[model samples]
Target: MFTHFEPALMKFLRDLQNNNNRDWFNDHKQQYEDNVRTPALAFIEQMDQWIRLISPHYEASPKKVGGSLMRVYRDVRFSKDKSPYKTNVGIQFRHEVGKDVHAPGFYVHIAPDEIFLAVGTWHPDRDSLAAIRDHIVIKPGPYLDAVEHQPFTEFYEMAGNKLTRPPKGYDKEHQLIEEIKRKDFIAICPLNENDLYQPDFCKMVASRFGRAQPLQKFICEALGLRF
Candidate 1:
């Protein structure tokens, strides 16, 4: 059953941030499961049901590993930092059709001083990016209307990396040129620490996501899929 996240969850994450080495995590593995993974799984299970009501396209994987619960271990192979573990908890509700992160998805991030909900396509493949851009050029009104909707605008702001100049084949003077330049199309809503501590946090998150459904559906439709 879903209740409230224990204060120790935050404490454990904070401690992990300071002592990111594997040795420290190895010693605290059980605590990690009890405080972090367990509750996170419960949250995902509950969110799974809630999100289905919004749209059957999204999924919340409940597996203890290789599922919606992102691995605490960081892939430091390519990066210079080489930290052994991630400081935050990441939960993604990906579209059923998406093979990986390249496709449209909804994300939840939890960490010390950083908690938010996001939805959109992040780092889409070349073809997918081109398709999204073309959709923006052809039917900008729906995209604009979705983001500008009062329910969505009340919480999220349009966020993503963008090209400094307009992309080729698109006019700089186009009304939606700003959106066409975006590489990652996303909307984020900040969540306070107290928000996570609430017993009704799951419901609150679901309601917020429902409010953002128009935006989610907009992206899905742009990609020629259903939400």
Candidate 2:
């Protein structure tokens, strides 16, 4: 039974932002477990049931490591900012066949600055990108139905990078050219902290996810995968 994220989660993350070093994190490790990791794992565990209602193909694994919950450690190998810890909680419900974040998924981002729920693919590979574009061109009606529908547009706004010009082999004059020009197909819904603190948070998330289904289904079809 999932309820709400403890308020302390945000406070811990804000504190981490100011002190993003290994020593500080090690000292505050118990706080991280209580306010962040444990609740996150519980959320993921409970969310699996709701997610299955959306699509059995998606998973919300509750494993402490290598599961839906993203790591708190920062990958600073190539980054200029060498801060060793992340300041946000990231949870992703990805498709069974999906390999990475690029796969069509539902993403939850929790941070002190902002909270948002995102759906669709981010930075898809060359072949997947081409396939989605081709599918959109071949079946514009369903694509439009997915994105332009009241349920989808009322909650989510289209996001992600777009090509400056028409993508190669796609006609600039085409009706769905703008959508086809996208390098990433993602939609985001901004959220308030209060929303996460609500006791019915899981229900709210599932409802919004239902609104995103048309787009998710289309993406799955484009990729020749089950939704």
Candidate 3:
């Protein structure tokens, strides 16, 4: 059974609300480990069970992906929006190894920020990033809709600093031909921290999550708070 969050743990996160900079990030490593990382570890462990129950066909991804804290920088002189910090945490679901950027599914921004789960459209591919390109261009509707409804305040005090847009040049091929994609990503705040726990919305989203791919009941069952 899952335990309720400790008071001390929440207080620690509250303290990080106004904190910033690499020094602050590094200085709080121990607290991060004790309160945040440890809890996140427990979360993933439980999530593994959910994955197996939801998509049995899925071969479990590595247990160690994002197993450690991440650096808050992207060394991209070749591109734009070069920030000094990574605004999100990410975990990949790839069938193959070796930086599987083309493979589908990655969780994002689960620590020190919005704990949103992304189901598609991120590429770490260097040579040929066609699949990722397609995700951003072809099926951008569903993910974009989810992004609009994101509520960062629930997770991060400094969520205002996070990425507001899908990275530059997200649509190179230009195939996002839908009203949903055309709609300005709204970025609505969550009605409640427990919004994810709403049975109606949760069931609706989980049911048609990937269109044609109705999610297993186990997935819907595991996504919300188990009462």
Give the best candidate by lDDT.
2
Against the hidden true structure, what lDDT does model 3 obtain? Answer: 0.38
* Model 2 lDDT, residue 90, Cα: 96
- Model 1: which ten-residue window has the lowest total lDDT? 98-107
lDDT of 1 by residue, 25-111 (tens): 999999999999999999999898888998998999889877788888899889999999999989998898977766688888999
The TM-score that candidate 2 achieves is 0.98
Q: After superposition, how far is residue 136 of candidate 1 from its true place, in Å?
A: 1.2
Model 3 spans with C-alpha error above 4 angstroms: 1-17, 57-89, 94-102, 106-108, 111-115, 124-192, 195-227
TM-score of each: 0.97, 0.98, 0.45
Worst 10 residues of 3 by lDDT: 179-188
Off by over 4 Å in 2: none
The lDDT values for all models are 0.88, 0.94, 0.38
| Candidate 2 per-residue C-alpha lDDT over 5-55 given as tens digits, one digit per residue, 9 for 90 to 100 | 989999999999999899999999999999999999999998999999999
The residue ranges of model 1 lying beyond 4 angstroms of the native Cα positions read: none
Candidate 3, residues 121-176, lDDT tens digits: the string is 23323322333234435545543443443333232111111233444555433444
Superposed Cα deviation of residue 198, candidate 1 (Å): 0.7
